[model samples]
Target chain A: MIFGLVFWLLVIYFVARGFSSRRRRGYRWLQRELPSWEQKNIINAEQGDAILSLYKLKRIEPRRKMDMVKVLTLIGAIFVGVGVIFFVASNWQRIPAPIKTILIMSVTIFTLYMGYLFSYQKEGFVYLGKSLLLLASLFWGGTIALIGQIYNIPTSQNWFIMLLWAFPIVPIAIFFDNAYVHILASALFLIWNFLYTVNNSVANYYYPIIIFLFMLPTARKLLISRRINIIGLLVASLYCCFYKYEWLSLLVSVGLLIYYLIQREEFVYLYASSLSFIFWTITFFTVRKIHPNFYFFIPIEIILYLTYKDKIRENLIMCLVGLLVWLNLSIYSFCLAFGYKFNVINFIVMQSLAGMVIYIIGIISKNREYVFSEIYKVFGYLVTFVCTYLLSFQAMIELRAQVGLNNVYLAVCSFLIGIMALLVTNEARKGYFENKAVRLELFALASALLVNLILLASPSVLTCTLAANAVLVIFAIINIFLGVELKMSSIFTAGTVIFALFIITRYIDVGWKLKEKSLFFIVGGLIISSLGIFLEKQRRKVIERMKQNE
Target chain B: MNKKIIFFFIAVLWVIVVAAMIISKQSILRKGKAVLLETLPVDPRDLLRGDYVILRYKISTLDLDQVKSEKPYYKTGEVIYVRLEPRDKFWEATAVEVKRSADSGIYIRGKVGYCYRKELGVIYGIESYFVPEGEGREIERNIRREKSSVNVEAVVDSKGNALIKKVYIDKNS
Candidate 1:
């Protein structure tokens, strides 16, 4: 199963590469280089021939400037790969001293040969140099992994001590960008450290955070964007939040937000703002749980509201709502567990009150869009809560009457609620939902109804069965809507969320179920994959046909 | 200035060589001085703290007339070294050499680094037996498992010249 996953990932990567190449005029430019088509081949084969010709071109063409840079890169890659293989084979504890000597001597000799090639006779010196550097990086990284494995039962103190020496190497790799040495080194360091951190009380594991921080300046300068840096920072922030560095996470998010806002880098802006929202949301939940009377969540909510007030435009509303829904669900779950019962009246009343307050504030500020929009959302939530309460009551009464409910009925009820919530959300989104905040509120209402229906229906059927069904249906619907609306990030985020959900929920289960229904599921998955490929093929065909006609 | 750039590269390379040497000096120096004992197995847990391979003499396998300490047992501070000879294919201490009456007895420098036992018979921290650079990794793995042990057989001449002859794992049950 694991190997299969790796294989499929490779396939996906290759296919993506192929498509990107085509988009970059790879076929058009390279096809002429190929020999003339044989008469035995076909009467008409344009699209397939283009792809094949492009592949042939990439394989055969001398990329002439395999110069100093390219040679160095290849050398580096080879070094890293060989280093890992040798380190694994040596198995430090099992080899005789003579053998160890011979192995090290051999590696040293290889390194020298590569070095000589780079310095003197190599045609593509840059490529050779890169390969050497890559090889070195891999060895450097593989050594760390080997060391960690060797001292598998190292003390926490010893692990930290080793980390002090090891963690700094990754940043150095980045500083040079000579190779991915830093990345490999840091990855090796992180793997063991990650294992140790789990079920341990070592507070504020700083290596990952430091690594992300170190990558930021280089990522900005060399990569031409803050995307990778932001992702790293976000992950670090999550780790910090998870491990109880709440205040630090908040401060870091704010600092990033201000830094990005000043620079006007969109990626940094989104990352910092979203992360800050998360930190505050988490803070609100945790604080409310710890001290119910503190009412700190209220102020945090206000801060979030103000911070995102202008930024959370119509398109970002659903995203914002999604965040809120998640936060509230966590809060609700925690609060209810601690003897805090939530009646429908109190919950609806609180939501309405919050919505009304926002609405009134918007009115007073003369943000007419906010006033009209937020009022509509406040009403939407009010109606949703009422309907949810009635339906749940009806479900209870039906259960009492029938003494049983089938999976089909559960599916029906869930689908109906989902559709209804979606329709109402769409209607509210038209004009009255001028404010992103209000649209977010309406989306939250719909999300809440959908979530409740899902939860209520799930238990009656098999455990993950309902979740899988609802997720696919909702995911498809949302994807189509988002695509039609041309909300790029939202569509991508939804797709990513769907992929993550499927991987997490069904990956292992599917793997196990594969053996039993091996033929069916495998065939189905393959068919779906092929269909996607076929669509791409068809699109290419249509484009080619259009060009010929033109 | 051109000379200086050349000098700088040379200096960096020199520094790297020096660092590598400093890290690996002890193991290199101890190479070929002693033979690994193939008859006895070394514990896997004891291979980590630098290139010294520590082994227990497998005294249970030997039928000895008596086991004796070379120095005073109750002494507070004593330096003792034992000279061992091959007896019936087993290495046994033939003579106990004591430096003073003031110290502990029976100090061995093989497995742990320079181990010295107090009057209470508790031996702590010995550093003995060095293996060359690459072999350290193998010894480390051997110490982790109890199936077989890599041991070195040393040839000693009549004049007490100890030279390593061969290395083998004595897994004879």
Candidate 2:
């Protein structure tokens, strides 16, 4: 209970942090960019001054102080309410059932009354008041658990508990316009969806009911990114409904991708990258035997091609997206031609290959095109690192997988990678190689290809494993250097952690004398401590450099 | 939608639900007949509410050869009526009917679990007994003891609804 309470408190911290003014950020950005705009002759001096004055007149800075107040009060009230709950739980069995019921009811009612008094009757404590109101519902859930425990109520029907937990508090969350509370409600609703889907064979028109009744209306009323996350939960529900049909699920995802791409062209990379995960899962883990039909890919590929053909040459993102559709179709064709079933090593190699290609394309289009480069690069990093990290294991390298597969995506992606590499080489001829970022991107791409080639050749398990580990170590170093160059702490952390794990994994399985092992542990501990200190100093230097540049 | 009114409604609604659940269960305990039956216990833990014992009653499985089901086989989740009559100190299943016939007295409704191979498995919904944390294993061990027996005392309503009132572990010490 305390852990759950603490977890929610942290969530509330992040939620409360969002109260810091985005409008202020917009002004700050304008303030910073005005001089650059002036230098570029995009806006005249008078217009810039007018814009500055307009922001100044609106008076946004004072809200920062209010955000602090809101966070503190919300945190404090939640602590008190959850404290009451913990107190009740500790003494639950000691008290008689009737007294326990009274105690639970009284506490719940009192919190509601106090919350009402503070929110409606008192002023300047609305944050605390609403928090208490939210906790009032939370207390009711505890009451349910307690009473159910006392009465021996069956929870084998997890759907019942999910329903009771989810449905009650959503209206309160919506009414209060509390995004954190609304998010929690949405999470519970998704849990209900999973439990219900698992318990009942039929999905039975359920999510559409919630989606129509509560989800969309709340999204409209609140109109925030948090509300948008509820839509993501709808995807999970739909996934649950169509879990048995991976083919139908993939088609649904592809349809969603096309719809979103057409509707919001700017967010094409994000929608594509996120929805691409469904392809990865369906392609990798599917047991359902799919017979390849050449005609199946024709309409789908033609539709995608006709839709994106005009944009493909002009837009780098669309260029890759066009290839993505081709990749899928080619997988089907390859399945037909060679009768190649999917393997674990093949999937990893292919995903890594494609990821590097996407990343190289992102680097190529960095400033030349209007692109959301971070999202593209993030998808690349996620697939590449995760795949490469898995390939490091000896078991994965040696495991001969004979599974049901209807796709071989690697063959087509290699062709795309070759063309993209040619484009990079062409750019290099014009002295684009001088850019360190492009050099790093090329290095990563080469490393991915080398790893894929090594895995493709049937070598001894030790050779593949060692080579994979070596490549991972080199990439880790590259990541560290890139992090240092770009001043990104997360990438730096990932690099150091991966290297540490690499060292740990090497020492883990090898047969060593106990004394030698102890010696290594002590020596390694000292080295890690020194490295941490060095990295901290370097990180500080990077931060200072960034600030100086700013 | 005044804030205070909503708060009042929410608070009142919670209290009413709690009260209603308690009142209904209390009515069943008070008015319904108490039937004792031998059962086996299996201990399992729930994440939130802690440990519980699943009671499998002797009456849970019905032999089709003895008192046949009305239907050839019942599908999962299909409601089936199980008529109980006193046999020694415990109640035994007399017949399982798709619908409660006129002679189906002192019966409880169960959802069909598996009804095939001349055997029918019925789930009475009174199978779960939520114990205090770490205590279910003790009761389960007692139920497994050869010298003694574990029995479930249940209160069955007129409309065939049943709730386990208590799990009596009569382990001879």
Candidate 3:
């Protein structure tokens, strides 16, 4: 406890000190260097103008019309081929390290030269050259490092340290005006970090920073380029979110957002900035371990409130961003709640509650989109519930320690849970006349009943209740399909309730099997088959009815 | 005002972010310092919460003659300097070093030391410890856990070369 206390104090002190006005030594150095850099930029601007004039003169001179397709193909082939070679080399032990190094270096030099030559041309060939260079670097560097690990020279740590240095070649390529190299570098850097993250090593943090820096030059160029800045920014934003460096990443994004705001000189920044602030405020509280649950509503509420304001289109963007953040937070919460084996109940309850709250908030706030947003969560909960029900009886029998003395009660409860799931599904569907959600619920309801019915009719079944449940389950499944074809969410929901009866029937049956029930099996099977055929006919009728209306 | 200026600012911001990202990547330090208000005397016990001596930092450089006869100054508060090192291959500090001292002081129980940086002058501490004390071991456990903060006291000198005087436990922030 003393150790924990002391540790936090040190953190508070250093962080506080860092935020203080005492200007970090590095910051002081940066301040001193900025003036000189400013002067250099002025020089470069003048020089660049002269170069542009020369470039115009050169443009009038004879020049080759580059065959971009051939160049791009060659570059693509090199990259893909490198992947194959690396894949092979990773598995093979006999390849000499020096030979592999030479092979990689040869391709590296060629690709770099090609990239430099194409830098000022159309950007298509530039991407190819850059990608090839990055791939070559990975293969050469990774192979040598792996071989060193095998030989145990300079230690594994040294090899890792070396790779860290080698990995920056992608960004260097980008810095030199080859965006393709940047892309290649970013992808490799992302993959490398992902591998380490899966290994749960602390060193994985470097991956995000690498990709962030790697893509900066490219992203900067995009702000001026007429083509697809949004897509580029979105990708970078995703990378930032993925790597858990959203703070600074978001700050850099805001700078871009500010530029966009100024260009349009619109109030969109108000919406964007508001959404950013509210989302982060909630994130901030949650991260600090203070009143996490209360703050979760802040973003949703602000978004809904903003909808009633003027500039509906800007508000819509804010609403969408807010909704996305809420969902993101919910997913994180769900993982935290249900990620552990012991938290199964907590997971289900929390997700259900979260979904229901989102619905309630949407209704109260009069934000239709917020209500519509919860379809996936509702479907997720119901599908998972029904699947669990399908396996419940067997699960109980297999994991006896969990079932205990309340086996019959547990079985009945599983059935009830399935029924409760239908209630959630109905509420979800009723909230949105969304065809997608209704159809999905139909799939879940039908699949669950079908599985239950199979468990009953199979000859080697252990219990009579299982067999009886199976019959009811089959009927329920047919009914659901019919409802789905009719596009009636309510009717489909009712079918799910009927499946719940299979659970209830199991509870009332005192004996494990209904005595002398062999005849019932044959009759039940025949009836089920006939009912399925009838439902198929009904499905055809519904489709025909819909077509006639159209 | 113009596209060029906008582009230039963007470049500058990117570079700034890159630099910040690099420096921020410096892993947080897990060790903290605290002062012992009173001297604590302890016995060696194998099962005293996993074999560590509970340390109270006495005056850093004790006048062995002054406190030699009285209560062994066991309960008198001493300043303890906690040494933490960067995690190497074995998750142990490969090159162990003192972080920062709270202050420089002369006394058996209040003196602290072991301050060194790769490129900085050492700062001495007000208190130091004779350990197998439980506190030192707890500090070890903390550094391993990568705890967000550790407690260190500010020992200000006349020259204002303030170092972390000692490592101490504080219940409240």
Could you say which candidate leads in TM-score?
2
Q: Write the per-residue lDDT of candidate 3 for residues B90-155, one digit (tens) a residue.
A: 111111112233444221112222222221111132222222324445554554455422343433
Output the better candidate (1/3) by DockQ: 1
Off by over 4 Å in 3: A1-107, A118-167, A172-180, A195-207, A213-531, A539-550, B1-173
**TM-score for each of the candidates:** 0.43, 0.62, 0.37
Can you give the DockQ of every candidate in the order shown?
0.04, 0.39, 0.02
Clashing pairs in 2: none
Off by over 4 Å in 1: A1-76, A92-124, A142-179, A182-196, A222-232, A240-255, A266-269, A276-288, A292-338, A341-550, B1-173
Off by over 4 Å in 2: A1-114, A122-132, A142-151, A158-162, A165-171, A176-341, A363-550, B3-8, B15-34, B42-53, B59-85, B94-107, B112-122, B130-148, B169-171
Best by DockQ: 2
CA lDDT, candidate 3, residue A532: 61
Question: Tens digits of per-residue lDDT for model 2 on A1-550?
Answer: 1232232234323322432245446667777778778779998888877887664422223223457777776777667656655554343477788898888789878977876787779988787777877777667666766666666667656566656766766666766565656766676676666666665554434554564457545654344423344354436524532454444344434544444455343233223323343332333233333433333344345434543442322223333333443354446445646777545566557667777766765666674663446445655565577678878876677672223222355555567568767877777777757878668757876776787777766456777787788888888788788877777767777677777767655655342435677787786677667767776777677667766776
Better of 1 and 2 by TM-score: 2
Worst 10 residues of 3 chain B by lDDT: B89-98
Candidate-wise lDDT, in order: 0.42, 0.64, 0.39
